[model samples]
Target chain A: MLTIENLYVSINGTPLLEGINLSIGDGETVILFGPNGSGKTTLLYTIMGIGGYEVTEGRILFNDEDITHIPAYERSRKGIGMSMQRPPSIHGLKTRGLVEMCAGKRTVDVEALAKKVNLESFLDRDINLGFSGGEIKRSEILQLMAQRPKLLLFDEPESGVDVENMALVGNMARELLEGPSEPDAQHTLHDLMHERKTSGLIITHTGHILDYITADRGHVLYSGHLCCADNPKRILDHLKKYGYKECIRCLS
Target chain B: MKVDLSKYEFTGHASEKVDDLTRLDKGEKESMKMAGFDASEKNRSASFVQIDHNHAFCKSYDPGVEILPLGLALKIHEGWGDLKWKLLKPEKDEFTRLAADSTHGGYVIRVKKGAKLTAPIQSCLMMHTNKVGQNVHNIILVEEGAEAHILSGCTTTLADQTAAHIGISEFYVEKNASLTFTMIHNWGENVEVRPRSAGQVETGGIFLSNYVSLKPVKNLQMYPAITLKGAGSIARFNSVIVSTENTFMDVGNRVILDAADTRTEIISHAIASGGHIIARGHIQANCSPAKGHLECQGLLLNNGIIQAIPELDGRMEGVELSHEAAVGKIAKEELEYLMIRGMDEEEASSAIVRGFLNIDIMGLPPELKTEIDKAITESEKSMF
Candidate 1:
């Protein structure tokens, strides 16, 4: 569903990411492990078409459509959604209203959805205004639930959440990647198992999210290059045994 | 500089009084509506409607309220003569001099003691003559333990009318009383407006002022001052202005906290969309235990100028005074965040502007709040 071939990205004429080739097929979820300032967010922002992230070489193909140079809004309209690590707090823009906007033409019961995340009181509050770290993460999941994009880019879903809220965010991330716990009448149980097609590229550090959602494939992003391709849990175990420095041998 | 009053006629376009405001033509009523007047009169306890140089209508429906024109109030009430120009000096400026020289028609509204009316009193000063020089002097008195709100709308009846309006207003809130004055201005493109106003609050009194001007005015300037003369008195000024092409405005408010425990807050939101605006705010605390704050923020949509001047002064050692002022365009991160939520550039910008000028914090009644919302929407059309 998504493809980045030899992606070379930079900001302010300084190269931050180079020779990055990655793809997430339909119905596939990928977990990326990287150290801080290792061009992890730069890659995600470049994929999302955010400004100031200049794609110097190569291109990004989403469902075979060339969207490397398109604007961020256009990418959002083309079934790409991103949960920023630290999104700006827009004054006067209510969380409920923004969730509804994310749904576009589709109708969304905002209050009902907000209740699922225990964010009923935050629905009327300004977006991310004075929100705690856990509240922001839950709000991100709530917005993504409304967006219903084919491919989701979650940046550190468990970063700021407490151990109590981590379960909610992780399980919600699973629901976003896979279908809900129960399928609707339109899809049979057999169809649900085979036809579900939402994809994801989640960034996580501790791999504690693995306790809730199962990741199909994992890769360590070391020095802007994807290396150490293996099972997500095995990669997590390897990184725990020896930090990101040991993964540099895989680059050689 | 003195206004060239000779360029406009002060008389000869006499208009007859209308018993009912709804009987007016659609365009005239629309012009008044844009300025926050309610033609239906459903949400008002009393009303005062004036055409150019005529107090066409002035009446009070609630028995607890009394309304009278300036001419009648000065003659009938024995102590009202001492109230005129009491808070504001007639020689303060040329505009005040003109208003004092010929009081075309202004109203004096007084709420009786211990009366708290649910509905507001609406007053519309509409100028219809082509080049009429309209002048008015208004006064409001809230007795002890009484509470009242006044919604005043001033406008020219024509979109391109070349007229001039000069208004002088003085309000007095007695001990333990509450008074809220909300003024909306929708003058035409060629219209020049000058409003001079001042107020005083007694012991334990509360004074709240809300000013909104979203339409075009060639030249406009006003700076109303309120003095808290008694202990525990409080005052706040909330102003939102949107100036478009060919418009120029110099508007602000000043509050003086002279008594112990008195507090004041002055906040203004100014937006310049290809026009020039000078937004000013000042607060002074002269006694211990007094507190005051001033905030003036400006947003520039395009090629225009926005000057925000906020001043705070403290006289006594125990007094607290502070201020914050900023003038710039919308933050880039704020715009991009909205755009990625599925809205295009224009839609995102409009949302930001509406939020920047949001009036939900002003505590306006439902009727006047709807008027300000409509004005914000209309002003958005000129921005893009």
Candidate 2:
């Protein structure tokens, strides 16, 4: 559903992501593991079409359509949604109001979606205003659920979330990748195999989100380059045995 | 410097336009609807409508509420009314004398003691004659233990007519009474308006004022004052003004907390687009245990001028006073945030401007609040 080829991104003429090639297939979940200053967020923002992240070289194609020069809002309109590591605090914009706008002619049950993220109590408050760390994460997930985008980009979703909220956030993110949930007593196992799926590219630092989500593949980004692509659990075990530097040294 | 009213002195006889009490033309009726004065006549009690120098209509639909002409009210309440006009709006300059002398007619709205009015008293004042100076003197009184709401609107019939409106208003809230006053203005591009007002809140009384001016004007200057004279009284002033074209405005509110445990709050939101605006707020806490806060925020849509002056004075040892003022163009972060939510640049900026102008004042009728929101939205649309 998403493709990038030799993509070089820069901010204000300073190259951040150089010679990068990545892609996420339909219904596939990919985990991106990178250390600090490794341009993980820069890649996400560049793909999301956020301004100030200039694409110096190469192209980005989503669902066979070139979205290299599209604006951020238009990118959202094309079914690309992101959860930021640090979202801004909008003083007068209510969370419910923003979610309603994101729904955009779709009769989505906002209150039910907010309840899934444990943010029902904060639906009426200003967006991200006076919210705790965990609350902010949950609020971001709430908006994503409301958006129901085709390609979901999760940035540090498990960084500040607590264990209790982590379970809820993790469940919601899993539900986003898998199909919607349904409790049934009379259902064949084949019915479960026929569930619809969604595409997701999640960026994780602590990899704690791996406890709840099953990824098809994992890639390590180091020093503005993709270093390795392997099994999700094996790469994690390799990094656990040896730190990021040792992994980068071995890859080099 | 004292204001010289020499050039503003247009004392010639007004054109002989017959006052039609029973007739409202299409344009005049549309103006009234725009001002939120098109409610059913049966829905209104103690209603009045004034166009230029004519007292178009005045009627009382309830016994507890009385509406009368200013001249007749002064004559009837000569001994009992709160007509100490000079004490509140002292004839300190030529402009004051001009308004007091050339005044045609105004409304004197009074609610009897212990009266709880369910419906608001509505008043519509408009300028229809070109080059006519429409001066009015208004007085409102709420007797002890009474509760009332007043909605007053001022507008102009023509967009380019040259006119001037000078009004002097005095309000009195007795002990345990509460009054909510809302004023909306829609003036022409060449009109000048000066509305001088003051209020005195007695012990345990409350006075709330909401003022909005969302139309172009040649020049407008007003500084209304309110004093909490008795113990435990409360006063609040909230205003939103949007100036467009070549309009110039100098508006402010002053509050004095003189009794023990009294509280006052002054808030204003000013928007200037291709115009000049100087928003001023002043608050003084004079007695022990008194509290006051003043906030003024200005949004400049262009290179047009905007100045916010906030002054706070605390005299007594236990008095607490604070002021916060800000004036700037729209923030890029705020604009981009809205864009991320799917609005274009123009839509995002206008939404922020509208939200900035939205002040949550308490105790307004839902219908009135809707009207006020509609007016603000209309002004926001004209900004871009």
Candidate 3:
């Protein structure tokens, strides 16, 4: 459902992502593994059409629509949603208010949705203000659920979360990527192992997200390039045994 | 009392609205509505709707409280041929004398001992006639162990009417009494207001003053003072002002702690859009074992100007006082963050401005707090 062909991104005239080619088919989920500063975030932001991530030379298509030059908000309106790793705090905007906006035209039971993620108490509070790591992650997931975007982007969902919170985050991410389920529908890891007509591009370095949602493919992004694409288990095993240094060697 | 009006001269000080005392205009009720006053309410009423020195209506709701016209209150409280500016006797300057000398009529509110009045005594003072000076003297007296709440609103009916309002209010909170006074001003663009008020809190008494001015006024200058005269008295001032479209406003609050173990706090939030506002907050701790704190915050939109001056003086050995003041525009990071949440630039800016004005002042009645919040939100919507 999402495709990036020969995407080259620059920030302030400095090349960040160079000639990256990636695609995730309909109902397919992909895992992107990269080390620190390997342009993983740049790729997600470029796809979401955020400012300052200038696409020097590339084309981005979602559902066969060329969205290479669309603005960020328009992209959001066109069913593109992202969960940032470190989203900034909005001083006065309440968490529930943002969720309501994201659920535009959709009669969403926001209170129940927040309660499912144990975020009901925080709905009235300022968005991301003084929230813990686990709380922020939960808040982001709650917003994404409210958005119900056709193509979802997840950035380091497992980072800075505890074991219990990681379980919660992983389960929620799996259900969202699985398809539209009833508000009361309960899905286990086995249910998410089988994919449906919902696509996602997840960025992770530790491969812990694989514990809940089984990805269809995994690609190694090194030095702003998609080095290789292979089976998800093979890539995780390779990274666990040899680390990203092997990927760099392969690139050279 | 003769007021020397040498230094207090302005351009239109020559002509004053003569006492024609025209009947109440329909537009007067509309102006009252703009100031958030409803005439149909029965429990708490606008004891006096004085329109440019005319006593429109007056009433008292309960036996524990007394609301009377200024003329009748003066004659009754002072007896015949007695000079009884007892509580609000003019002192210090010619401005007080001017208010005392040129004032036509005002309202008198009194709460008897041990009376806990839940409903707020509402007062609406409006200006309808053009080129008129509405000068009045108000007195609020709360006897020992009494508790009361007063809501006063001031507004002008016509947008082009050039009027001046000078009011002097004196309050007395007896021992163990508490009084909460809230004043909301919705003035016209060409109106000028000068309100001078002072209160004395006796032992174990509490006095709270909340002021909100939202609409555009030609000029407004007010300095309200409260003296904690008895031991363990407390005083607090919570003010929110929005200056828009080239209006000039200078407002201040002063608290004097004259007895031992007294406490005081002053909080002022000012938002200026193309206008100028200067907020001066002062606290003087004259007795031992007293504490005071002053906080002032200003948000400037566009080319508006704001100056915050917080002064603290501790004369005794055991007095502790602290103050903090900040003035700036909204943070860029906050703006971008809200934009990412699907709010446009204007929506995000208005949200921040409204939040900046929404300060949490302690010990306000829930209904009053809600009213203030609604007013702030409405003002924000109509500002741009």
Docking tier of model 2: it is acceptable
Best model number under TM-score: 1
When 2 and 3 are scored with DockQ, the better candidate is 2
lDDT score of model 1? 0.87
Candidate ordering by TM-score (highest first):
1, 2, 3
Question: TM-score, each model?
Answer: 0.95, 0.88, 0.81
Kindly report the docking quality category of candidate 3.
acceptable
Q: What is the lDDT of residue A192 in candidate 3?
A: 47
lDDT for each residue of candidate 1 in B85-191, tens digit (9 for 90 to 100):
88988788777887777778789999999999888888999899899998888989999999998889998987689999998899899999999888989887899
Mind giving the per-residue lDDT tens digits that candidate 3 earns over B87-182? 455674555676667766778888889999877777888776677777777888898999988888888888787777888788889999999988
Position B294, candidate 3: lDDT: 96
**For each candidate, what is the lDDT?**
0.87, 0.80, 0.79
Candidate 3 has an fnat equal to 0.27
Best candidate (score: DockQ): 1
TM-score of chain A of each: 0.96, 0.94, 0.93
Q: In model 3, what lDDT does residue B72 have? A: 86
All models, DockQ values? 0.68, 0.45, 0.32
